[model samples]
Target: MLLPPKDSVLRQASFTNFWISRILSSTSFQMLSVAIGWQMYALTHDAFSLGFVGLAQFIPMVLLTFVVGHAADRFDRRKIVCLCQLIEGGIAALLLVGNMAGWLGREQILLAAAILGACRAFEGPSSSALLPQLVPKHILQQAIAWSTSAGQTAQILGPSLGGLLYSLGASCVYGAATIALLTAGILTCFIRVERSERKTEPVSLRSVFLGLEFVYRHPAILGTISLDLFAVLLGGATALLPIFAQDILHTGPWGLGLMRTAPAVGALLMSLILAYYPLQRAVGLKLFAALAVFGLATMLFAISTNLVVSLVALLLTGASDVVSVVIRSSLVQLQTPDEMRGRVNAVNSLFIGTSNQLGEFESGVLAGFIGPVPAAFLGGLGTIAVAGLWMYLFPSLRRLRSLSES
Candidate 1:
């Protein structure tokens, strides 16, 4: 009798296609962000506006979280993701035309940002839920690791490429982004997966709240998810990089691109290592340790005047972050059933979005009141505190020894 191929997810055709799609989409998203951030800062020259960019995207994510989660559970996730990429591609084209025609303003940018946020609200949950369908159960953790590596690869390219393209013009960046997103859309369309039987439960508050309850009831899953939520919420300093690049680092758009790229570099390297080696033991202790390192790295970046030092600090943050990410993601997926992945992942997505977008807003507000340096310093300190607190609050998480520990 014929048998399936070896254990590597890379050998699976569907998984390969999924990984490629993720890389393309992630790269396009990163490039788009670089353009939006630099353009917003250039137009408004204010920290609050930068913060507002995050808020604009975040608001839609918050409002649609339940609906999108339900849609992922009930609909064809591939189609949902494909539709989002296509719409985002069109949005990029609109930005391109608007920029070239001199009609793009802060409002237009914010509007596009809001639309993209809504699209991601659907895309993030569906894509995450689709992963387990592509690989065998035994190799799922490796698949998650590889998937992270794909995103990091995109991050490595996206910011630098976006920054470089921006020098030519914002239009150049937008045009390239449009093409990348369109290609990603097409790629997503071809990805194949054996989806779980769709949940036919009528849309209701009870159904929508199921994911939240599922997460809350599972202490380990809740711990990992909340751990990431709070850690990133406190440690996120990415929103301030444009300011750091232009003002403190004494660099231009190109420098900002590199600064944005630094963490991805660290993350990609770490993810690749994890993909090959995989985490074997003391996973819980490692998660907290990574958070501590990430916090320390954030603190270092905040205080550094030299660009090189800052980049190094950022790199450490990324490397440490992926360790926590791989562990958390693996645990969440393994713990949840296929039928529940969509809703559960949606809840997870909300926490992630909240941490990232809210963190940006918080950073901007804090930076506005005090200064970027003090604001970032405090954020790092806050992240460390969250780590310590979570250890005590979720001893189950702290005691976790493996992703499959059950």
Candidate 2:
């Protein structure tokens, strides 16, 4: 596929549509999370049930990881993403109906979570693999930065929007999400990629597992992926925000929405900066430095009782996280072969899913046992420890100088 000319990324109609669609899709997804989290907590009032919600969603992704990667490599990635968005829209409608009819119980909520997770398992990897096709190679990294900005913008808006809508009613949030997702799907249908890759390979266990194998073969890729996994697995504090908002923070859903938006505000600013003036030198050291900063920020959030301090800590966490994310995402795409891109990205998503969804579950369970403050505090300590250990164990990753480096 020939990319657009050298000037701007958004100039390409396909890329522009994709970018806007990303905003819509991501915004809806983020909004759904806030609604689900708040609604579940309102219904159950148990910290453990909040974590259970994450686990329910996560299990489907874990089960479908290998299979989803194969589908991305074998099928039309754009179409796959389109289908996922449509399905998600339907799910949102279901939630709306359930909410309006007053039968959306814990069982219904968890089931919906699981179904949405399965769809995302496919959507995320397909979109990751499809991104490079829309822009010139020289600006791929910048496109990624802009792409990160799109998602961060959604995060910035989604939670707060969701929280606000909840004041009107849960059905309003779901209704808005449904509209956004459907519009996103329509936008995706406009994306036209050159379908030149051969899909002749038969489905087999060996083929499905190839992405996992490829990641292991590249030490740099392995290190970055695992580093994110461990760091987020330990440092995820967003999961406990409900407890904080309701109990410690003593705020309503509106306050929870603002709390969720805080990190995204920081992330949006940082992503815009990286898009314009990207990292140039000592990329490796910068990665570690960002990781360390993320850990410290998590620690700060853990102990803080004041809303301002906690929001500040989350802001730092998001800013620092985007640094590692952009570096890792660029490196992963740059390093992988086009034929293997889908599978590799799927492997990447697997780690991401584990860290995010499972991490939420872990935070919930730990919070249930020890309390949210102690759970978050220990998790921050664990993140710092992982950063140190990874630096020692993956010297090549620590020593890497550029995304182009093997």
lDDT of 1 by residue, 107-139 (tens): 999999999989988898899988887777777
Model 2 spans > 4 angstroms off? 1-11, 34-53, 97-111, 240-257, 303-306, 361-378
Q: Give the 10-residue window scoring lowest on summed lDDT in candidate 2.
A: 1-10
For every model shown, what is its TM-score relative to the native structure?
A: 0.87, 0.87
Separate clash counts for every candidate: 0, 0
lDDT string, candidate 2, 1-406, tens digits:
2244654544488888899999999999989988998899998898988977878777877898888888888888899999999999999999999999989988888888888888888898899889987776667778889899998988778877998999999999999999999999999999876556655588888899999999999999999999999999999988999999898878878778778888888888899888887787788889999999999999898888888898899999999999999999998888987778889998998898778877888999999999999999999889889989999999999899878787
Off by over 4 Å in 1: 1-4, 7-11, 36-54, 97-110, 239-257, 302-306, 364-375
- Residue-pair clash count for candidate 2: 0
Please list all clashing residue pairs in model 1, or write none if there are none. none
Worst 10 residues of 1 by lDDT: 1-10
